[model samples]
Target: MARKKHTEMSFLDHLEELRWLLIRSTIAIIIVAGACYFIDDYIFNTIIFGPKDPNFITYRFFCGVTHFFGVDDTYACATEFKFIIQNTEVGGQFSIYLWMLVTAGFILGFPYILWEFWRFISPALYEKERKKAALFIIVSSILFFIGVLFGYFVVVPLSINFFATFQASSDIVNQFTIDSYISMIKTSLIASGLVFEMPIIIYFLTKLGLVTPVFLRKYRRAAIVIILILAAIVTPPDIPSQIIVSIPMLILYEASIIISALVVKKQEQNG
Candidate 1:
């Protein structure tokens, strides 16, 4: 069946469509979240708190890298870090469980959410463009999951290790609240997931003639500075952590430029 072109939708009609789109997306998320609630214990203990262990995959990989370089085991190679996590408020643990379920739901249902969003916007696009929905959802979901994994396996581990090991004095013990720990994980995962949407964002901006590859290239230096700042903000304060985070973001920016250029070329050819 062919999709009907919606070239004559009124403002209220558009609003109504948007409302349904949001409603459907929210329903999908809630359904997934309901499932997540049942497995909250495993998710929280095994997955969310995995990075706190010194023997996490990320730590082992870094340790191996340091060994290959024949460097002293003071930096990434050192893995002996101990920290305790506590819940201060009465409902803190329950709140964390609920929020984690919601977050997991969002992550798991991301592709469906994208599908609904694409459906909502497709009528505004050309028939040829409407056919690209599958590609859009697949690529976007892949990028988002990659970003989530990077955050979980790299950023979160490095951050936990750094903070766990770093001490102002021997008298002070690091007892992080459950809220703080979960907040850091949530921020890392969500922020990286969104950051990895750079290409998609660039495509839309280019389509709207609000951005160009030339413009991106011209501000490449400034962009690097901003990336570094963002990296610093997201990851641990150390240079290595910042560099690790910044490298991927820089790559994403460069990829966005290429994507924007391709979009412009295609637009020109079509016009």
Candidate 2:
């Protein structure tokens, strides 16, 4: 059947289109998740549990950096973690496995999801704007993947290093539940991925007249404060770690402002 024009579609039709879009996106995630099951061991052991090990690549890199700088901090150069991950519930491991499979699926299948979303929205866009669908998907996916990596490599390690070694008393021991560990990992990866889409989000919001470059500039200080707070929340409570996390986010905010400006300029030119 031929697709109806946007103007010809009723509210119910638009809702139906959105429903199918979600259905297709869900199916794509499930398909990718099925493939992820094959590498479950690697995902659980190497990727998820890697940060718990003191010898993980991120820790080693930081250790090397500290050595080069002659820093006396043993936190970076530690050879072991003080915490143990345990699953108290019989089905906890199974539940976590399924959750991670879906998470991995969504991350890997992000571009396809974007394609489906674009197709749904493309009908409402001008021909020239719709032509940029591939660019949008590519850039969005790249940014998301980069953000995931940042979360995994930079944020996760710092968090694990801090919490794993924190000592309230010599009598108390830290035994983290598997559920909590996976929850942290999931939140970090997903949050970072979404945060990195700031520029793309700003671009669309600008086009929709909801945001402006002047507004972003005027509230630059507020944005910076919020970014720092977010950085502190995600990273270890250290100046260096917070700075490391905040820098990329600050750069993205500035870039969003520029993108918003260009979008407004183009809209004005067309008008």
Candidate 3:
């Protein structure tokens, strides 16, 4: 293919560039996915099932905290968790392997994917803007991983414990489908990771003059309501769990407001 001149590239040229970027990003994901496939036994047995065990670190820590508080009546003193996952289809295991690998690919290749996105957009931006955006891919990638960990270790375990132990009818047993269990884990991690990037998202929106600090502040009460709703949705229906989930998100909202304000100030100076 003939390369377009640097100063004469058309919209189609840009689209062609984007095509290569995606191809490279997909290659990176496959490399990481292959590694994940090899270590999937450890990943599935350890990290994925870690929360289902009573000896999970979170449970132990919660037990210790309850002891330190001299509260003896809580369910945190449990010795073993009482839930089992059952695969209901003949090809379920094979399907799960494929799904897990793809998810791992997306997670591990996130930084490269972000780089591709940046590359596709950077040519249209000013040098100053490009410099600012260069670090965005890195920062956002880190925040996403951190958020995934937080969700997997903190929120997912808590939810599993609560729902696993809660009894609705004396005759009903809790034998959860493997697909359902895995879906919950995947959803929690991915959702929280994206939620944790609010400040970064807000910064870019501010740069584009799309969101303002005043707009965030003016809807403070409304934001609070929405945060609470999200908290209830992602977390178990307990006051402490809801509060724990909400605090970080609420903090993100405040940080977004600050970031937006700074971006606005910088824009004013430049204008």
The model with the greatest lDDT is 2
Clash count for each candidate, listed in order shown: 0, 0, 0
Tens-place lDDT per residue, model 2, 1-271, is 2333557778999899999999999999999999999999999889999989999999999999998998977988888898889999999989998999999999999999999989988887777788799899999999999999999999999899988887889899999999999999999999999999999999989988999999999999999999999999998798888998999999999999999999999888877
The window of 10 residues in a row where model 3 has the poorest summed lDDT is: 1-10
Model 1 score (lDDT): 0.90
**Which scores greater on TM-score, model 1 or model 3?**
1
- Stretches of candidate 2 off by over 4 Å are 1-7
Give the alpha carbon lDDT tens digit for every residue of 65-85 in model 3: 989998883577677667789
The estimated TM-scores of all candidates read 0.95, 0.95, 0.91
Off by over 4 Å in 3: 1-22
The TM-score of predicted model 1 comes to 0.95
Indicate whether candidate 1 or candidate 3 has the larger lDDT: 1
lDDT of 3: 0.86
In candidate 1, what are the lDDT values of residues 1-271, reduced to their tens digit? Answer: 3456556889999999999998999899999999998888889889998888778888889988888988767657655676789999999988888889989999999999999989888876777778899999999999999999989998899899889989999999999999999999999998999999999999999988999999999999999999999999998899999999999999999999999999999988977
Q: Which 10-residue window of candidate 2 scores lowest in summed lDDT?
A: 1-10
